[model samples]
Target chain A: MEVVDEGSDGRVARVSLLRTPLFEAHRAAGARLVEFAGWEMPVQYEGIMAEHAMVRERAGLFDVSHMGQVEVRGPRALERLQWVTANDVSLLADGRAQYSLLLAPDGGIVDDIIIYRQQADRFLVCVNASNREADVAHMREHCAGADLVDRSDEFALLALQGPRATEVLGELTDTELSEVSSFAFVDATVAGVSCLAARTGYTGEDGWELYCSAASGPALWAAILDAGRDQGVGPAGLGARDTLRLEAALPLYGHELSLEVQPFEARLGWVVKLDKGDSIASAALRQARERGPERKLVGIEVPKGGIARQDHALLDGDRRIGTVTSGTRSPSLGKAIGLGYVEPQLSRVGSEIAVEIRGRKVPARVVALPFYRRPD
Target chain B: MEFPDDLKYSKEHEWVLVEENVATIGISAFAEHQLGDVVFVELPATGDEVAKDEAMGVVESVKAVSDVYSPVSGEVVEVNDDLPENTELVNDDPYGDGWMVKIEMTDPTDLDDLMDCEEYQKFCAETSG
Candidate 1:
């Protein structure tokens, strides 16, 4: 990244904004671009609400190339993965993906990652854009002897999510996407581009995440849209992506899972396997679980207006109880929904609280995880 | 993005319409488009005194929160009562039904301080570039 001088229009240039391979496609589709992490990405194209509904009803495509991918291979790859991650890696067979976390030594979360078991001796991990460099560093430090390589630039990831995901992608690929069960992946050719199509997504919809070469990203994106045009496939952006994920109650790295927050406190204790033989924070996690977590993650809903943003103090009357991590007006639920940390006693559903929004206390209540769920 | 010639524009992207001593204020279409979807709006109440070039209200879009700076100093005579629940009007018709406030001016010459459509258009191009 480099700092550039001001433009001729007297405007400061965002010179460091990294453009993904699908940047031209997004611009051609009339996207509203914004800086995310270091990438200049689309926040919306048609509208967040419409795109949100489209994903829930029909299908939506997302360019997630900003998310970094790491390749781990060698004879000791499995042994190394089981030691660095918080999940039971041995249980994850080939072609399967598991949601796991890279835990810091202090029992804090470094990043929530997805490990795709490519083979007996190889794996691929997807990490957050903001934490990509840090996550790679963490893995390299702990994952000695195994061939760990930063393969981020080698792949462009696209997420086609919704009930019609299989159908839309089915039209473009010969993989028979319906055969790719949840969390399973297969090497396939899509629109003449080689891809690894996996039945995994953040939107909590029936969908596939396609990993293709960076050079074929723009072509694959255009081909998917062109193939799924009649299926009402809209190219969704980060705006709809945030709203959709919020509705699903998925923890974003910086928001819910951070260096300061532990897995137990983030309500992601299920991913932690203390018996998995001394992973990064296994001992600390055991100690943490023994002495109950100080605070727990709870869903907060503002039935009234005024969206509660991150760092908005959660209150039990005048006393500050916790803080909101992520908040948005959920397009699917038609209510302002958010995730926050609160004392364990007040973490139960139906417990009442208030969110301080712009100096005003907006009435809110503790709710269950996931403000919305797709039709079965 | 077209800024109507009849409406005076503020550098902060608020549009103003003057009739008699009172001026109706709203964010320009350019501002609304820049702000994706307005999820919430907070307006000054009637009888509240607003100063020129000062923040009088707030407009929260999906991605960002921005202060709605008042272009003229005046007594707040009217506020859009329907705007709290119907914030989409700010995006739907920013020039007409989306008018946020009506300020009875203490200084009628405040209009001279703001730019016309052409000047504001150039300002938008320069800033956006």
Candidate 2:
């Protein structure tokens, strides 16, 4: 593909200080580059669907170094985190990670993050690349006397995901990864680089996310690619990443879960603990649980044809009910699937709906969440 | 990319091969490369009248959807039905198997305004850069 010099505004400058160790490697590999959140990231390498299928069938590598990694240290770190976040952090043990949400005073979602308990006093929080600065600022404001450190620049993260990911990564390390359960991590080394291997990923596949130093990232990435070459592990970019996550029904920050939407409305009530010993949003969550959400997030599957895109109007007969938040033509399912907020009464499992695509109403059904689930 | 000297080209990156009054229309190699990994193609039906430089069909890729323009004013005589399932033929053999439609040209003199292989190559190079 030919590189066209297209310039936009200073949107890259206003976000955060973007840093990635694999910028040169991505560019050299003929990746079409774009500014995502402050970082210049690869949108596609060979093609979107090809990489998307590879991650579903075999293995794919991703330079997730752009995601923010913040460390909270000190004796009262866990206690402080539990008060500020919506998840029950007391249930987490050392080396275990939990998906949690940072909530505002009114119970709105600030950001969705994965909290990894490294030790009793130390925790690693991985947030979206676009919300890094705001997340850090939010953490500092809630920390009070706790030690809050932004380790995003110092560390680089890589995700090796798919069915063969474990086989490829296990060959490189001396430690056996067979015992590591899902959402559990182990401290180890890869190619002499000190790394933390987590058995967690966004794709609905068995995989590991390796976090290492920024300087050692390039070598570690090359080593993994070299080791997994025969096993069909290829470099994947943001396009595949988006499709994989969407198929799994994961909520993206700007799309499903945002500061304007509450966790209850987004159907993430499981993460928000209402009885976790008096947080600021506890009373509000309790009230929300009692009344239930007016609008609920649901999955819609288009049966015949047409693709449902963002901002497309969803209807029941002639009455407009809601709008699609995220939608795509699922390459795996060979059909169009989307997520949208609809009236709670109409958000049932076999509810019929219509999505207006290009002035035509396509038939769709509100099916169960997660249009695709990985076989265990 | 090679543009055969015998073929005629349109500004919208469509090529025309006129044999008497029957003209075969397919997108240029540049167009196929630009719209990577063609997933779905909407073809014009046979017996449909098409205007010159007008949209005759639509091609969808993973990234974007583009309209395929007709190079000559004519009636669609035949359409490539294989492209609906195997749209990647556009990327593989754009000139041969990827021919979108066959048209019975209303006016064969319209081919004179189209570019030859040399002129089309230079036009693509200058515009692409």
Candidate 3:
């Protein structure tokens, strides 16, 4: 497999882009296709704002089949996973999922992953699209003596996310989705296709992600869209997906998690189980825990006006402090918000700062993460 | 896609409405359509002087930023103050409510070089292809 490098700046190389199974569906829906993580994916269908609003108010369907999946099965699967990944795999109960990370030997992040414990000795690891090849190589090197299979090409993934996601999905599947709590999974049939239904999503909304055979993708997609036609279910692309995740403060791979960034620095320290017996980068993470991270990631807002974008320099009275990692004009809040890393001391909430945009300083303030949250 | 017959257009996709010495300017519908969705706009002050074919303002969409060039040289007499908060006007009604600026023309002869609606419609088709 050819491994393409998508730089930290988010620029794509003009190579032959791969297509998902639902590429024709996106084109039929009038989606604007853009190359993302080496795949020709839909960036937007109707518009970013309208699709984002639809997902928040009703339901949205996303074709995330480009993401890579790995299966580890054997009597020693748990031991091998515990040795390679940062989190304690033993804590993951059967039919439950966990958000964890694959770490380098020096505590740098390889990729942020979600592990589904399908059985006592079976696991399904979902990895980022851009890091699929590298993650497989890394896993094979460390996770020896176990049957590790790269099942990325065999499965198609769809994320149905929003307030009415369950209601819409419930109509098509007899999985009793409501009983599958957050971060849980069920192996059942959806739309007459056998699949794994997981109640998890990156949009910070209550939703379920379905994984089915590649040949079953188009059929299931059509059925869900038909079932969700009345619930305001719209075909959403990556553009709305990005803005929604940004509002939720969920980090993307290249933007928030990178080889040079540690979990603590990215405000993802919860996934790093230092006490979880000898795993990859445990020693380095222990030392970093002792010394404390010098820099910290923070959520920032330009309450007055102006949108800050990636690579925009942040300033403290002309002294350069950090660079914005992710930013967008929030469709939900009707304000500009972003995420960046800066000196730990400067990351305090209410601390005033400035973002330099096109040689002009835009006043900003540090705010708490997750710029948007679903009200109970 | 929309070239208003009442306005003259620049090659850079800006539309100009010349009435006496005052020239009202905004982007063409083709420009707005190519720009997806407008989320923010940055404009110059009312008194700022601007030269024709130069960058006078910026229109930012959800994905990218584009410069709005001046169609004719002039001193800025007025700017659309509501554009900062409601940038969608550029996408909704580019010819009317979305006018970016009104200029006190420094050279009315500059209007002679601009394309009329018929010529601009052909130009848009050729350029887009």
Per-prediction DockQ comes to 0.67, 0.43, 0.71
Model 1 chain A worst lDDT run, 10 consecutive residues: A1-10
lDDT of 1 by residue, B1-129 (tens): 678999999999999999999999999988998987887889999999999999999997776788999999999999999898888999999998889999999998989989998999999999778
- Residue-level lDDT of model 2, residues A196-302, one tens digit each, is 99999998888999999999999999999899889888899987888788899999898888888888889898898776787757877888888899888999998
Among these predicted structures, which one has the highest TM-score? 1
TM-score ranking from best candidate downward: 1, 3, 2
Q: What TM-score does structure 1 among the candidates reach?
A: 0.96
The digit string of per-residue lDDT tens for model 2 on B1-129 reads 767788999989999998889999999998887777777677789999999988888877765678899989989999998988788899889999999999999988878789998889999999766
lDDT of 1 at B71: 94
Could you give the fnat of all candidates in order?
0.53, 0.27, 0.67
DockQ of 1: 0.67
Q: What is the TM-score of chain A in candidate 1?
A: 0.96
- Please give each candidate's TM-score: 0.96, 0.88, 0.93
lDDT of 1 at A10: 95
Backbone clash pairs for candidate 1 read none
**Which structure is stronger by lDDT: 1 or 2?**
1
Q: In candidate 1, residue B39 scores what lDDT?
A: 79
| Interface DockQ of candidate 2 | 0.43
Off by over 4 Å in 3: A1-14, B107-129
